[model samples]
Target: MAFNSAPKQFGTILLGVAGLGAFVLNLPAAAGRVTLFIGQILQALAPPWYGRNFARQLVEIGFYSLPVVGMTAIFTGMVLALQSYTGFARFSAESAIPNVVVVSITRELGPVLAGLIVAGRVGSAMAAEIGTMRVTEQIDALWALSTNPFRYLVLPRVLAAILVLPLLVLVADIIGVTGGYFIATARLGFHPGTYIQNTWSFLEAQDVISGLVKAAVFGFIIALMGCYHGYKSRGGAAGVGTAATYAVVSASILILISNYLVTELFFAQ
Candidate 1:
């Protein structure tokens, strides 16, 4: 009997390990599926289904997100300027402050940081709201009514996120530069005219464009993760909570990872 039980336990452990490995392996495939879903939705572009919802989502995801993004940009810019000035001062290159601030904000910090903030704020909210709907059978009811959930629900938020994030990042880039300008000119005693000149002189069209592109991608990731996790939510309240947590965490991680990849692609010679 003992020997028989030992074999059973060993089999159980082996099965568990295999399951874990399969889950790990399938993560990339799951991500690809989600991407494909998004692509299909984008390609379809059915105006009657996704348009009105998209406008509502724009107000929810974009208009409501401004204050947090603005505040974050301002403080980030101020701190970055201070830190950069200190570092550059050691090398007698403090005059590079404006250029560094502009390049850093436009090329990387503005979009990446803004996306992270939205992931935490908007991503979790979306997941929670949609997950609750799923748990309460509202999503099923919609399906019963012959409404395509993806067309009515997911596509709108996704489109809104993609459209709004670029605008938010643009505002962030400008505000961040202005914050850095204030610190550099006021606290550091740099000339305002020269700082402005240095900022514009070093920043190119590509830098701004690249950051906007990244913002759009990050926005899609944020909304996609939220909708995917939320729509597939199971169990009950606990499951809804878990989905929301995973949505935010996964979106944030993907944003950071993708940011590096995009930077490499854009800046690599």
Candidate 2:
């Protein structure tokens, strides 16, 4: 019995590793699928079947996530202001605090942090839910009923995430900047008008737009990973757990890597 169980356990581990490796190897294919799916969504004049599902996903992934993102942004902004002030004060450059906060939040921190948070919350949830459905053969049932799973299930989520994340990031940017403003004026002894003026003066249209673009891409990645992993889930309850974990981990890493690439593209001139 012990010998038989040992082989089974080893096989399981081997299979798990192989699955992970396959996931990594298939990144290009996943990217291709994403592009194709996006094209399908964009070309449809009015995909009535997708509308309700998309709205539901928008609420789930975006509206419900605002408080956490808002709190994260505010604290991040405040901490950034304090740290920037401390660093700049050593060089008598304290007046740069507002500008630093604005740039930091809009250019990097706001979208990345928001993406990470949503990955933990929304990504995991999506994976678990879809994984459970897959394991239960619901996805197969949808196919049997002549419904395209990609059209009905995956497209709505991908579209909703792509559309909603930018709005969330925009709100987060405003809240973060306000938090920095409050800290700069109230705790750091900077004049309120000076802080606001400096923040606004230093902020360009590109900084804001670039961050929103990153947010949209991050959202797409999060949803794609979740849907892909979950849709491919096998086994039973354990597989759902694994899918959720993989979704979060993969989405987070992808978001960070994509963020760096986008930053380089936008700022490397």
Candidate 2, poorest ten consecutive residues by summed lDDT: 39-48
Would you list the C-alpha lDDT of every candidate in the order shown?
Answer: 0.92, 0.90
Clashing pairs in 1: none
Structural similarity to truth (TM-score) of each candidate:
0.89, 0.85
Query: What is the RMSD, in Å, between candidate 1 and the native fold over all Cα?
Result: 4.1
- Clashes in model 2: which pairs? none
- Candidate 1: deviation at residue 15, Å? 12
Candidate 2 lDDT (Cα, 0 to 1): 0.90
lDDT of 2 by residue, 1-269 (tens): 99879989999999999999998989888788757755654554245476788899999999999999999999999999999988999999999898889999998999999999999999999889989989999999988998777778877888889998999999999999999998888899999987888889899999999999999999999998888778878999999999999899999999999999999989998
Number of the top candidate by TM-score?
1
Best by lDDT: 1
Instruction: In angstroms, give how far residue 233 of model 2 lies from its true place.
Output: 0.7
Per-residue lDDT of model 1, residues 1-269, tens digit only: 99879989999999999999999999999878887877766764665575778899999888899999999999889998999999999999999989889999998999999999999999999999999999999999988998878888898998899999999999999999999999998899999999999899999999999999999999999999999889878999999999999999999999999999999889999
